[model samples]
Target: MDALDGRLIRLLAEEPRIGVLECSRRLQVARGTVQARLDRLQAKGVISGFGPEVDPAAIGYPVTAFATLEISQGQGADVRAHLARVPEVLELHTITGIGDMLVRIVARSNADLQRVIDRVVGFDGIVRSSTAIVLENPVPYRILPLVDQAAAE
Candidate 1:
């Protein structure tokens, strides 16, 4: 990874659908060179996968929230597996903070959100839980810093 790779990542982060020919033209490099670099990046897992970003509201789930979960002794895996089965749960993460797991959920409305939370809190070994509803999502997602690319030759 190098300046070239950084440039490529920045461009792709903005537009993952950009073609190799367009990338080469923008970077002033040969098409094959752009293709090779992308292949190498993917092979090394620096570049994962790409896809469209959809709105949860447009998909019928208008409500979004972050849930902090506290589990009973030795119930982390059980709680995690239970959360995974729910379609409303968009993302789940284990953290070192006060909570055992953090979950992102989307629902249709307040009633829907309550239902989802009720089901989640009902899971075995779940001791306590809290939620913060998202009033607005200003910056949802962004590309990670390309440290390897920063140190490239």
Candidate 2:
């Protein structure tokens, strides 16, 4: 990624609806150049997708929680498949720690969260689990600073 690509990504992150023509106008580059850069970015897996970001709170599942699952030996695939069938499991990651997998889940309420957790630990392979409810988000997820740093480089 070069300076031009950095600028283009920043612009897109700010205004995702802008088309290639508008990007070309703003960046003072040819339309083909903007289009080609975008194409290359996507091809290189830098630009993953143009899907709209959805808020779980807005969609009725406001309660957010993280769960760490301790599984029986050699059951990662089975546990992962079981979690995949659950709609409330938003994201899952295998991390090096006390637990085998870390999962992010959401629910309609506290009672609903219990239900989600129950489903998560229902499988035979899961030995134990730990959970923490998210009370607030002081610093939400972001990558703009990294993008700017990359641009400088």
> What TM-score against the true fold does each predicted structure earn?
0.86, 0.97
User: CA lDDT of each candidate?
Assistant: 0.87, 0.95
lDDT of predicted model 1:
0.87
Model 2, 1-153: lDDT tens digits are 889999999999999999999999999999999999999999999899888989999999999999999999999999999999999999999989799999999999999999999999999999999999999989888877888888889
Instruction: Tell me how far candidate 2 lies from the true structure as C-alpha RMSD in angstroms.
Output: 0.9
For residue 105, model 1's alpha carbon misses the true position, in angstroms, by: 0.7
Off by over 4 Å in 1: 144-153
Q: Give Cα distance to truth, residue 38, candidate 2, Å.
A: 0.8
Best by lDDT: 2
Q: Give lDDT: candidate 1, residue 142.
A: 60
lDDT for model 2 comes to 0.95
